[model samples]
Target: MATSVKSLSNKESKLIMAHMYVAFTALFVGATCGLLQTLERSGKFTLPAGIGYYQILTVHGVVLGLVLTTFFILGFMLAAQSKTTGGLNKTERTVAWIGFWLMLVGTLAAATMILLNEATVLFTFYAPLQAHVVFYLGLALVIVGTWFEGFVMFKRHARFRKENPGERTPLLSYMAVITMLMWQIASIGVAVTVLFQMVPWALGWVETIDVLLSRTLFWYFGHPLVYFWLLPAYMMWYAIMPKIIGGKIFSDSLARFTFILLLLFSIPVGFHHQLTEPGIDPFWKFIQVILTMVVVIPSMMTAFSMFATFEARGRELGAKGLFGWLKKMPWKDARFLAPFIGMLFFIPGGAGGIINASNQMNQVVHNTIWVTGHFHLTVASAVMLTFFGITYWLVPSITGRTFTKTMNKLGILQTILWTVGMLIMSTAMHWQGLLGGPRRSAYSEYVGNADTAAWGSYQIAQAVGGSILFLGMIVMIIIFVNLAFFAPKGKEEFPIAVVSNKAALPPKVFENWKLWIGVTLALILFAYTIPLIDIIQSAPPGAKGFKFW
Candidate 1:
């Protein structure tokens, strides 16, 4: 049940591929920095050229975590919407281009500041650890660019609905609109903090900054930011993977419901990231912690949905017994395997998230390298692998090229290397963190402290893992290039699975944007308004900015 689809026109393909170019380039540069950081942390290597470890760390975080993810998500979503809705109209395409240029310019400006050592602030850009004004401005531009892209998606979807009166909205377009909506809402917190708080302070317009307020606002965006990354991966799992595996979607209604759940829950739960911050009230933190826990529902729902999708599909292919269905899966198809492994990683990743959200458990791992390991599993592994999976087919589809069997084999090799690398690196990180290893610092002896000394072996293990992951990155970049430029010209299908006829049609109520957006806002205001007021009124003396680099 392939939903037969036409290839995107060259203009639209070019628009999307622009994002791919930036994204893969960022992957190369960011992974290099990551490898260097791991080696430096192992204490067997020293950074040359007077490069600060924090500078490279900042680049690693911002480039991979922010720039690469943001660019790829936008590009992919644009393709999704375009594919589902016939194609982007002239106006929509122009708007997307405008968005891309803004983001590219913003990335360049911020990267320059970082390379010059003027901005060592990490991706979170926590306040009082200020960077150059240009860096903050650059980030703002990037966010604004995404907003433009979001607008284009919304407009295109609206046009889709208007033309096709009673047709159920295409699943991919519906999901894209929801994802962008979540992003637009969640990003407002960071946008507010940057424009009003950090921007002024960085320009010396303010003498002191409300450290607690800045932090509170940041986590407001910070927690949802993780979902902003995860939802796209979920999109692939729900809508695209079934087609690749030659199966019908398990349940369309369930998939939409899961995404709506993420939108409602993802925004209000940011306080889970701030559980240890003293200025926030314990009661508010408790409330938000419960909200964070609610997020597990959708995550589990997704897991359940994937399981059902797989089992049903496998049984269709004549699989027998409980575990036999797993064997029926397409193991050699990198298109399926990469994202399938990503789903597997999220099982532990989601469990780790639950642990991080718990007050008692958070007390153990707060600010430790364990938190770093946690996200590496979720975003870097689960989300990234899925993106790579999407790229394998997507690049060729958009470029009017065929994905050769040779490249398919290469993609499988890439997935294996990435899975092995991440398992080794993330495990070492979690273990070292449990032993009291701190995150975000270079090699240190701490006067030959025993606990710190115990972390040495783990650091070395991390270096080895990072080296392997870098190799995986190289393989991925090679595949991307060959698919985009060197592959033989032909039409490649953009796979979108048909809904199972046994499943009930999705309810129109799910299309009620007003109800859901209103609920989301109400939840956020209820969770944040009181705690935010408390922080501002009881605020301590604001701290001036610091440039550690």
Candidate 2:
């Protein structure tokens, strides 16, 4: 029966292939737009206001970051976890395909309108400055498509639990589930916007929707969505690479804890995004501030747990010194080591991240390059680097083909170039932000007496940094494209693979929702407690005339 199931699984590889095709296009579009944005900012390429540069930017962020990636992750998780967490069958597969097509159509519809300049919401789609109704409708369809994929994941998890009643989940499968749960809970913001605002507006039902209310709604979805992009990247760090390096996980339970923490704390921390917005009460700010701090707990724990894992693994492998793990860790093992280095960068990134997510600090730095630096530190460092590594690392497994060693090394080198360059770039960006540089503008054409010349200096640095980032990205392109065209064909077997798709034990019906529920409760407790206190103290909106010791 297991062999038959295994044989049937080969049929599903096409789904992953389809997803890869879509993903590559999305990545291409996304990267291209990013390059354009960089060029426009440089003393290089400038787009006239009437030229719809912001339109392209919207398509870029939405297509690459949201649509393409969302569908790709959905497809990847659907296949990767199906057999491992519990095997999904043909019906679920069909559902996923339906989801994919819906999203594709939605993307095309929205992209067309955006290009035509009918949809100018600029990715965040802040309301009042309404986009074409089709834009909102298209977005709704995209989320609906995502919901299909989410539903399929739940169905598969259910089957796995029922069939395998007494075993623990495979690590990859476990993480997939955590991501799905996070998506389920975190998507409320966008979902609400579509239902209450976009749908009505699109159908000519409403004249104006409150932009702040919509932005808040999106944050409810948006902040956690950042983690959705991130967790998969981290999953690769925790699950796949260590095995390639011949190391045991330092702590599996802690990894689980990190996912749980992100699930609850991530979205609730969204109020920090609203620190600059109006109509929010002081109580809301206080609650957001506290949740922002609570967010640190899990990230810090992950830092400790992941570092401990690496150190233990390094030590066991005969690494030495106070931080010899840094030096002695296997840099040559492309799959194993690249992600380890990437995780090291996340430490400062996470700290800066917490500050960006803080009420007070974000007020000082929000909308500045500080904000840009924070995310570049994250997506460029964590998501893009790790995902590139995973492309090199996982493609062989997924394709059942042998990748060229030279190409693998090229990919690794690219990741390093990007990581190091981005570190410098984001650092400069963070500093400039501290110096009052604005972000998300076409250019710092207005420096407001803040050494506008320094803006020129930093822009030069960013230009250099952007070049480095592109070099790495080009290497990434070469490696993935090469693997797609030249990697050897035929199914490769997992070295010591499990025979079935069912995740071990605790079927969906019997599953414990309490763990995640408890996590949400804890997050709410930590997130809202201070806001509750603010209600009592009646703090003012400006945060003015208040000093903390």
Q: lDDT of all the models against the reference?
A: 0.90, 0.69
* TM-score versus the correct structure, for each prediction: 0.96, 0.87
* Candidate 2 lDDT, 278-329, residue by residue in tens: 5567677777777767777877776775676667767877888778776656
Off by over 4 Å in 2: 1-8, 48-50, 490-511, 518-549
> lDDT tens string, model 1, 435-469?
66788878444322446555677888899999999
TM-score, structure 1 vs. true: 0.96
> How many clashes show up per model?
0, 6
